[model samples]
Target: MTVSAWWFLLVGAIVTYGWRAAGVALSGRIDPNSALMRWVACVAYALLAGLIARLIVAPQGALGDTALWMRLSSAGVALLVYFIFRRSIVLGVTAGALWLMAVTTLAGG
Candidate 1:
């Protein structure tokens, strides 16, 4: 990468860890159950949900090309399998990956 791009990466890393470092420095100084902490947790979850939504709805490359209904249905089946099988996250992820592969094959994509 160019020097400018390398500097951007370094700055991004510093900013990312700066937040963690600040949190760590403040940890125990503030109550974990405080409103600020809850709000931060909610924001974190919202970001996570947004990322998943984008992956499911907008995707990219090979994934973006998959049928939307098939993708949603595959996720649903995986979730069902996860709940029905004693809530095994590993099995759930595996089932989702397998489901997507099967759907892709069935769709001839």
Candidate 2:
């Protein structure tokens, strides 16, 4: 890989590991069921949802090749599967992936 790529990898690794370490260090002091922890969890989930929405609306790389309808349809099916399966991660992911593949296959691209 190029120097810039290596630098990014190194920086990413450091930051990821640092956050993990910080979480671990704070875990003992923080109550998992506390209001503050619940708020943090909500914020984390919101951030994740925002990122997913951004990706669907304006993706990059290979995902960008997929049509907006296909992406939205997949998300809708995934959500349906998740709720139908009582929030089963495996089934939701499988449903979404299969739906995307089926749509792409039917589109002939």
Candidate 3:
């Protein structure tokens, strides 16, 4: 790679690690059970839910090409797998992705 590309990569790594280092340094002082922490968690979950809803309702890129019913069915299957599997995120995501791919392929989407 070019020198500029290497420099950009180095800078990106430094910036990413800088935040992580700062988080680690401050983690000891932060109270996980505090009201502020609870609020942050709630906001995080809300943002995640909103993003998921948007993706299912009006996706972009290749996902937008698929039918709404296909997306909704995949999401339903994912949720069912998630709950049945004791809320395992990895399993839920894998199930959703596989279901979408299978449906898209079979339906020629």
All-Cα superposition RMSD per candidate: 2.7, 3.2, 4.9
What's the TM for model 1?
Answer: 0.81
lDDT of model 2 at position 98: 100
Residue range 1-109, candidate 1, lDDT tens digits: 4478888989999999999999899988989899988999999999999999999888988898889987898888889889999998889889988998998998894
Candidate lDDT values, in order:
0.90, 0.92, 0.92
CA displacement after TM-score superposition, residue 46 of candidate 3 (Å): 1.1
Clashing pairs in 1: none
- Give lDDT tens digits, candidate 2, residues 46-87: 999999889988899998988999999998999999999999
Tell me the TM-score of model 3.
0.63
lDDT (Cα, 0-100) at 82 in candidate 3: 97
Better of 1 and 3 by TM-score: 1
Clashes in model 3: which pairs? none
Cα misplacement distance, residue 67 of candidate 1 (Å):
0.8
